[model samples]
Target: MSTRFSIEKLGAQGDGVAQTETGQVFIPFTLSGEVVTAARERNHDRATLMAVLEKSPLRIEPACRHFGDCGGCAMQHLEEAAYRDWKRDRLVQVLKGARIECEVDELVACAPHSRRRVTLSARRTDAGLLLGFNRHMSTQIVDLDECPIALPQIAGALDMLRELGSLICATSKAFHMTVTVTASGLDVAASGSGRMGERQRQIAANFAVRHGVARLSVDGEIIIEPQKPVVMFEAAAVPIPPGSFLQATQGAEQIMADLVGQHLARAKKVTDLFAGCGSFALRLAKKSEVHAVEGEAPALAALDRGFRYASGLKRVTTEKRDLFRRPLTFKELNAFDGLVFDPPRAGAQDQCRQIARSDVPLVAAVSCNPVTFARDLAILLAGGYRLIRVVPIDQFLWSPHVEAVALLEKPRKRR
Candidate 1:
């Protein structure tokens, strides 16, 4: 049945929420203050947008043709000012939920076509191979002709990658491919595809070379390596391992790094926990001696090489240890005057506990998940650390995800 709903607000998942007789109903692709006609699913509190009876002033035309169908982006219809405000409000709301109050800086916007890494889904069908992002909330692939959020090199290579997927697909099963545009060239990594025969391997290699790919790998096995994929971290040109973790956009990475470096400018000794490929460590080492710790051996090895090759950088040491299994103890953490940690989405709960107990004078916390970041910040607040400021960075662009860099400092006790 069709029902008229006045959208009350936008939910955390970028869905418009409406209060109905039963309860709140979430409708995708609707905006706040807009009267929308939607068909409610039977026995479900959700509705699909049918038409907009009243349009919102904050609503703008989405830039991409596949905006509604593709699951890659959300909130693309939001106006620039409204979108940035919404993202910043998300951070503020998350912190308030945890009973932590602080000043949140304005949202740092990332320009369009700035994303350097993108993961695409591919599936083989009777007609041909289907490659692009999966349909919204579905496994069906939406074949992409253009993506405005990705780098030109990556966006332009979609057809080329689709062709490559045809030669390497060993079965009718769906698979994942991650394409990263580095300083050298495109680094393509395909996984979940069945084993490749010699003939298939040869074909894949020839296709990669013809397309000028820096390196191509399947299931962590290198098929062809025309050149090492290198990514510049400040002054260092670090060679990235296949399928390694990188910041979604270089602009966001630099913003986060600058915040960390500026916060710990005076500290002579610093420790970087959960450092991935030395994004912050490399930049901070220009002024301070840095000891970077990470769980991935390959990432730490890359960081070490970056430090070794870079000129005029301070001493940088790396340790391969799982911070989750074995967080640095309070005593161990005391060795550094300053600390910076960029944990995964789950946040550094265990490490934050240890940091809470320690007396690290200066600390910078970088997180992509605001909920966990708020939890960790509460822990630090209980430990008598004052939050200086938090900057929300729109790294994922139209997506709901946001990155933040928070600075904190503990007062020195007088003897």
Candidate 2:
């Protein structure tokens, strides 16, 4: 018999931790304050839960059948309200630890199930094309017949794609086929296709003909009718390639822009760092002078196009520069009165350092990774910045990730 225990707290990755007599174990979908039975032990001294002896008040019945298997969403089992509160607590803890005074506001709730886009990996099995996400921590594919979180339209296409899988030879030679469904149509990419030369092209053509996709791309480049630009928020429409980054949820993205606009409206001039396709810059341009900086040259071109269509007036100055390699100096950084950052998972550590030490009056740091955000916030705090407002945005629902928009004001000098 395995000794079991109750979870004390939720970890950063959404795992519930419980230390038994033997050792500590991380269990998924199990909430803190819940007692569970350990089923069996696995490699790396891990233990799986057999049954929940007692459920926490924060526990909720999982809505998805493939909740544990899919591995896409880790916290759907917890009550939505409790899950959000935990996220808010994480940010508060970060600020408190640094001795920064800030009002952690209510988190913006995202639509529970409205993801219009989904990228699934397809494997060639003896039976057929296994289409779904990967296993918990392994590359082994967990074939899902249906995904609950995906938009209804995209989820419907999974069956069609799976049935059509064997008809094409792209499955045999590729490592894993990529299936992306956009507003236009489906796009597929087949890697490890040295065996199929012309066959691969013909397969794509045949797939396009059968499904009637408005656009198709084998790799990053387009192969069929060009995909129309995606309309972001309520106003801006950007022409993004298949692999290009777009906010996962269109509705949530609009909310993000609204919050940014509200914040930037107070500033006379703002600098948006890692501003891919002018996500925040173009919209802020409607009210203030926005200097958008991005590493990708093509993204800047798209940002320019968005500006031309969204607003004929050019309040945005797009600069193509790699901030990681060469961070903007304090002298150059002082040009902006306010700053908005939407960096990648790495977060804007170096860029945040530059902003803290600069003379910018107001700063807004938006990040997807909380760990890096906290670290960067500490740097800003030490440099005479006072945290005023923190707004957590649940753009990726049920997932462990949390996005936040933090407003920091430079501390006033004491006479």
Candidate 3:
């Protein structure tokens, strides 16, 4: 079935929404104020855009030809300013919904082809090796001839990666191939490629060396290490663990570090919660003594090593603790003058409650999900902490996801 509808607004997922008398219909690749003809999906709430009868003025040429089908980017077709506004508005809208009041800064932009890390799906297909990102909401992989969003070093090596992928591919089932650009070279990690025998592992190792790969890890174990793969967090050189969490882009990481660092500059001691491999901890150690906490032992070890090897830095320490299971109590949190937490998408509901009760003079929060960020902000606000400012960062670029750094300050009680 086909129908013509006017796009009412952009949804959270960058899908153009049209409100029918029944409910809202989500149409992808369509923009607000545009009249589009769409084929009705069996799901009823989703529609496939057949054609745009009227196009929005904000529409712009997408940088990549794979825009719609690739699933890596969503708002690439929208104009630059509008795209940024949408990202910033994501924070503002969520804050209001959470009943928290604060001024959200404009979106800090990131350049195209700047993504330092990307996880590509790979498998041995009858049509040769299929290596690329999965289709939008589908298991199907979109084999890439080129990726404009990835660094040139990564995009240009697509063919080479395919050949390398072929070497370790023991089964036809699709697997993840995470490639990260580091100071030494490309660090490639593969998982779920099926069990590999000694011969298959040797072939993969040889291919990694010939192609100048920094390191190659399979199923969470290092198969070959040609060079020590490290990423510089400000002046400190930190080793990135295999399949560790890294801010999607180097540019975005710098922006976040600056935001968190500048806000907590006055504190002599800072505790970084949910810290992964000392992204902000080491940088803060340049000024304040940092206690980095994370659940992953490998990441904590790497952070400890980075701190030990770095020169001209204040004391830096690491604690391997599962924050979710047993968050630092309010009494424990009072030990730190300043605290910064960058939790995963679920946000830090449990941790924020403790921070809220604590007398930490300054707090900086970095989160990828606005909804959860707002929820946690509400918790902090309820506990006498005043919201300062929130800055949205476009690290995911054209994707609907937005990252934010929020500052909060607790007023001292006078005697």
Q: What is the C-alpha RMSD of each candidate to the true structure, in Å?
A: 1.2, 3.0, 1.1
> Higher-lDDT candidate among 2 and 3?
3
RMSD (CA, Å), candidate 3 to true, equals 1.1
- For candidate 2, give the lDDT: 0.73
lDDT head-to-head 1 vs 2, winner? 1
Worst 10 residues of 3 by lDDT: 406-415
Ranking by lDDT: 1, 3, 2
lDDT of 3 by residue, 187-289 (tens): 9999999888999899899989999999999899999999989999988899989999998899999999998899999999899999999999999998999
- Which candidate achieves the best lDDT against the true structure? 1
lDDT of 2 by residue, 1-415 (tens): 5556689888777888887676668877788999987755566345566788998987778877887777778888888788889877777777677676678888778775577666666667788777777766667777777766767766777777665444444535335445545555655544442244566657755766677655555555555553463546346676655565567776666777777777667787888888887778877877788888999887888887878787544487888899998778777878877788888889877887888788888788888877788888888888888777788888788887778888788843343
- What lDDT tens digits, residue by residue, belong to model 1 across residues 1-415? 7899999999988889999889999988888999999999875688888999999999999989999899899889999999899889999999999998788999999999999999999999888889999886679999999999999999998889999989889978899999999988999999997899999899889989998999999988899989999999989989888988999999899989999999999999999999989999999999999999999999998989888999989999999999999999988988888999999999999999999888789999999999999999999889889999999999998988999999999975453
User: What is the number of residue pairs that collide in model 2?
Assistant: 0
lDDT per model, in order?
0.92, 0.73, 0.91
Q: Over all chains combined, what TM-score does candidate 3 have?
A: 0.98
